[model samples]
Target: MRSTSLLVLVGSGLLLLAGCAPATGDASAGTGEAAAAAALAEGEASAAAPSPEPTAGDAEQWCADADVSARVDAALASDTEGPHNGVLVSPEEMAELGEPEAAIADQRRAWEALTDDEVAFQQCLRVRQGQSPVDPVPGSGS
Candidate 1:
């Protein structure tokens, strides 16, 4: 009976050690494959992300042109007294004004020459007129 009990204890100890042994080579390979898959997924997500739009840097370059400036200034000045005061212009209106045949030829020409940032600014202005496709302007950074 004593010998049988000692044999059972020894057998159980060996079983536990075998179960706890370090993972073999294939274990790391499985982990590597999982990491590779995750990296690929991340790559795909980044590729699908949209590129950032252009920014306004040279206001003078686009808006400073006499022909364009006149239209932009007129558009800006026209809403000076309204609730639209301090707003830029709408994308739709900007698109219309950009057309050469539009009644507001000057405004269109100016809008056409605007940088993406300027265009974005104009969009913000249009928001004040309740023409924005998104929420109202967020609080000022200041």
Candidate 2:
């Protein structure tokens, strides 16, 4: 059972790291998430006074394409393993993938598929990623 669990984890991790085939589109194609991303990024610089908190939903919209990629890569590194963890695709590679927006759509779908436990785990990750602490998950003391 443990081995199977590990395999599933490893497989999922690999999928995230895998680069999608190149597509022909504008760099900003479907990325309409700058405002929210700015809020999130500003959260780091303005820890003293968080004016507009970035909602957990649609992190892409809250940040620029580069920042969105960095956030996802950071989350991946914190949760996964291997030397390649947290390593983002090169700018060239991202261009091939049709800009940063390409990954956002796929990432949103994957986020929706997360289980309860996974969601909690990611919440903890958010805390580590400089997001403010939200209410504790029910039944998860502290």
Best by lDDT: 2
* TM-score, prediction 1: 0.24
lDDT of 1 by residue, 1-142 (tens): 0100000012111100001111121111111223533343234234433223323423433344555455445544552232222333322332332322342344334446657555544443332222222122222121
Q: Give TM per candidate.
A: 0.24, 0.28
Among all windows of 10 consecutive residues in model 1, the one with the lowest summed lDDT is 1-10
Model 2: colliding residue pairs: 33-61, 36-62, 37-62, 37-63, 38-62
Give the clashing pairs for model 1: 87-125, 88-125, 89-122, 97-108, 98-108
Q: In order, what is each prediction's RMSD in angstroms?
A: 30.2, 16.6
lDDT of 2 at 17: 21
lDDT of 1: 0.30
Top TM-score: which candidate number?
2
Question: Candidate 2: where is the Cα deviation over 4 Å?
Answer: 1-99, 132-142
Q: What lDDT does candidate 1 reach at residue 47?
A: 41
